[model samples]
Target chain A: MSSERGRGGKARNWLRLFSRKSPPTAPAKGKRDATPDAKEARAAREARRAQANAKKASRPAKTMLATPAADGRHRICVIGSSHMVAYKLAADETTIDPRLFVHFQGLAGREFAAIEADADGIFVDYEKLLLSPRHLRPMWDPLTDAIAYDAFDSFVVVGTLRTSHILKAFYEWRTTGHFSRAYIEAGVEMLIKRDPGVNLGQAIHQASGKPVVTLAAPLTAIAVDVGDQAAMDEAYRETKAAIEKGFHARGLTTVFQPDETVLDASSTKEIYARASQTLAGVEHEDEERAHMNAAFGKLVLPDILAAAGAQQAETGAPRLTSA
Target chain B: MKNPYQSLPERAFWRPSVSEVEPTAISDVYRPKFPVDKSMRVVTQGSCFSQHIGRQFVTRGYQWFEAETPFTHFPAQLSRAYNYGVFSFRTGNIYTPRLLLQWLRWACGRDEAPDEAWTNREGSVDPFRPAIEPDGFASDEEMLASRNGMIARMRESLPSIDLFIFTFGLTEAWENKESGVVYPMCPGTAGGTFDPDKHVFRNYTFLECHRDMTEAVEILRSFNPAMKILFTVSPVPLTATATGEHVLTANTRSKSLLRTLAATLSEEHDFVDYFPSFEFIIQPPFKAMFYDGNLRTVTKEGVAFVMSHFFKAHGAADETDGDDAPRRRTVTEAENDDLVCEEVMLEGAAAR
Candidate 1:
């Protein structure tokens, strides 16, 4: 019950489950409802887990992951801000896209900094870099390398458009019903070298001539106390898609946050973000409300990896020859 | 017993009106036919100059009625840049009385607006309001949807308007020859390619302007039965003339016709009144100093002087509103200015 309450951000579904179950009658009005048999419930739970694991295993080997098996997997670099946490978790756990190992590069802060690059490859001191908690100071990481150009076949970049800012706009727009065309123009214009993430991604793509796939930022959750999800969902998806359209206009591939993990389209289910905030290797929960965990990555990876695979085929530039 | 000239005030004569007086202190240019209160839901539309009225109404504590409110989080700087709150709605510059009538007719469904949208290699555009969408809409459907949204808001809000201030810009316009669907700007100048067989240039005569305005008022009255309609003529001359006559000659004919019609209409209709903005700003004794180097665009001092005179007579403005006055001069304040004449888009042809 405590665990269920802890992960109850998306509690409506669990409430439905509880309502449908024909549980044994309570002893009295003051007492809690009877628990289902532990052995039976445990067996059923294991069975569901087994089915999910089998389903994940059934997918092709090229699905994106953090650590590549090195035996014949395609390797691609994943670059982002704290938003990259989910990709790392998903890659560490399950099959996301077809068999592709991610050389994930991520960091925190400096959202408006310009990119720096020279002849010896896009500048980064990989040895001094730390891994991805991002809760305290901005930590930099290259999934498993300092990275030269030829290390990966392609790259996936997240944190392009200022999703958090747009999320704030979406909430205010939804609540107030005032939509500014000028704000949209400013946001669209910001998707260039002026923005830190876009600058880095553009610089790296330009240097390597490798196809770059950007991850569209996820919609943030707003507290929903009423039945306004239908309206909010439409606004959420419409806004997200519009932002994606701007990137599409700029000649880049995009991997949008998938639909199923989206609860109310305003934000993802708690199991994906809120529940797994403190996974075994990660530190404190809720250090950032925006970052997602591996659970979300698992649900969203297929769409992302599929987009990447499609881009690779479309832009048939050799993956790594010159570098 | 006294002749009409003997009964008139000293300001009615040229010496007090223009000659030997302080240009700023000469106040008795107009008297209101009906009272205008600061509380009335006043809506403003028409030529580029009308924006000055709308902005002033807002800054001066008038209940400037706006239908198209921007989002809550939309920043003030970007909101100005995006051209929100420039008018009651984002219909861009209406430019002429006929355009206003056409919009009113379309609003009440008294007339069927042309269903076709204009397009080029870039994107689709609303022929009636080409510059409303900066880069143009993604498709005809999108353009129509957006235009329909504006129409819906207009129909919904027009009835609630207590005062409607309109400005007449020009007599010349480019429109669909078959349907008489007039555009704010001619085809090709702003968005579409010009096809001689389809599009025609129209210089509206007095009868046409009067007739259109009459019908437009009837349609508007259907929204708010007792709405007061105030009209003004833009002092800015025509940017470029479509008529083969010299631009100056064309400007004179156009302004004269509009002024004559406004005077006639004010005399005829008890509800209608004309403000002598054009007469006060550009008519001789001031040496046309109100005009910039182009001799077309009105200067900031000119706009300020005109608006000050107007508010003193008919508005409830104060010193605070006067602080941000004369927005016409600087480019920054006018960045999101919708007070543009689409005919100016034809300047290249004259240069060529």
Candidate 2:
């Protein structure tokens, strides 16, 4: 279903971050420094800080994601599951090249499965899209129910085959060490093949013969920031790498998570998740870490747009990049 | 006067055992030498029928040890497509005793698997397990790496296994003239080319089957002395025979030979036992009721009957029957009936 929501007006929901929950505050320092117990705690904290600094130093320098060339005009329609909420928020705040035009259209994750492709174009089946209480929210009202094949130069498919969903397989492969890397990767690919979002992207690409870029769901936040989380971080990185490789192998252009947003090796930084909300625009519970807020979305917005631009350019250059 | 024949159990008389009872109600068909319970770690190998056995063991809460497993996140359907969790390992239908011995040798480090691979427009296929990957492997190196990984798992899993169940599938195989290596199917049918000069058909004789099985069992014992063996002959008929004989006669001869070998092996080895799964389906009294319309694939009813006898013999409850059957649809009848068989591929060739 499409609606003419109109252009060039700041959306009312653009400033939704006010409802975000604040991140945990760091421990107070001045008064506790002189006490015996506080002194011991201070030494332990210093030791942990030193260890974390060493790890950060040892890690490779983060790569800056390349942006699209400002010369050519491009139209991009970003469609996907609930992760689109973050992108919507991020896109509004993003100052972009005058040549680029991007639009947002999607339902909640489960309901998004109702979107299907035919010879005409991609369209949402209203009857099949059943929304839960947590998923009830207004999606971008496009001009028509069907996304015409010729409407956009490229598409950005988001929130399909989330890395968090398949992290168990990654950990199992790491811990068991029984299967070959190729075998485990193939299994990951098979799981990716079953994702409704991935299938949709592939179908749209096949139908339109247009470039469809995919962005994996980012890792959720971890409970605690302390400890040598290098192993878990590495696992997440490796799993994300596998998912990206799998998507590329299926002929879909893939974009990695913004490296700066990732922390504790396996999760998005606390700052990005400070005011995260579910697709319903309700504030996320303290224990909830799967969905990130506007800040996280904002970080990823540029990279996704750049990917869409890369597909439009058809430069044949390798698009796989990480920070 | 008391005579030996008069004092025998009802099972010993054909009239009482066969004539008096319904085919489904036939009892006392098998008597296992040892007790099998949930605690024992059971590993299954051999033909397609053995898949049903391993699946039943896991669903019935028995310890069906999976030596090799796919990634935990792999869905059940995907794993099955890759031939994982179908058997204890990923070897796609060992089929014959010769193939069993070959796998054992490679796994035990007694011999190395040949580096030979079959190639098509898709990619390379492992000679030993051509159908293991639904899509052909990316390269020969990938195929070998996957194979070696599986063999290593087999080696690692053998030592800890408490029971080894092997089903005898076929009497015919195609062999490489030089290496004397037997393939699970005719080469060309699955992946490799069939050459008149290089690839030759082999209908393994009774002695040859026995020798191969005996060696395989010895290898298993060498790894774990306490491991027990259970043998069953698959009742599924030969889909097509390379031999000039009619397929029906070829199937009968092939099955008879395997059945005879199972009986002889079980009788000779104290650690080995035979289950009469073949007789349950093929016997005249059963009227071939266990077979589908094609009379080739075993029906779900047939698998249930065979498994019921095994579980009943072990004194374990068969939950697959009665009220619990509805809840236990994890392994659907279609999955149980759809065997990952290389031999079935020959039917396609014959159609041409």
* Model 2 interface CAPRI class: incorrect
> Global lDDT for candidate 2?
0.74
Candidate 2's error at B221, in angstroms? 1.7
Off by over 4 Å in 1: A1-196, A199-217, A223-260, A264-266, A270-323, B1-9, B35-38, B60-62, B69-90, B174-177, B191-200, B314-339
Q: What alpha-carbon RMSD in Å does predicted model 2 have with respect to the real structure?
A: 17.3
Candidate 2 pairs with clashing backbones:
A1-A145, A2-A144, A2-A145, A3-A142, A233-A265
Per-residue error (Å), model 1, residue A211: 9.8
lDDT of 2 by residue, B1-352 (tens): 9999989999999989998898888898899998888889998888888877777787787888876766655666556677877788888899999999999999999999899899866788888998887777878887887788889888988999999999999899999999888899888888988898999899999999989888998999999999999999999888889889999899988999999999998899999999998899989898888887788888777888888988899897767662112212365433544677777887887755
Q: What range of 10 consecutive residues in model 1 chain B has the weakest lDDT sum?
A: B325-334
Instruction: Identify the leading candidate in terms of lDDT.
Output: 2
Q: Give the per-residue lDDT of model 1 (tens digit) for A1-323.
A: 01111221221211111011122333432211122334465568567656654653453332122233345445666676567666665665553234444555555444213223333344332212322233334343423223445555666677645554565455554554344333454644554325556656666677687776776556554344434665666566657766666666545677667777666656656556674432224553563556677667666665665555533443332121110
lDDT digits (tens) for residues B73-120 of candidate 1 = 434444444456766877878876788888888889888677788896
Worst ten in a row by lDDT for model 2 chain B: B322-331
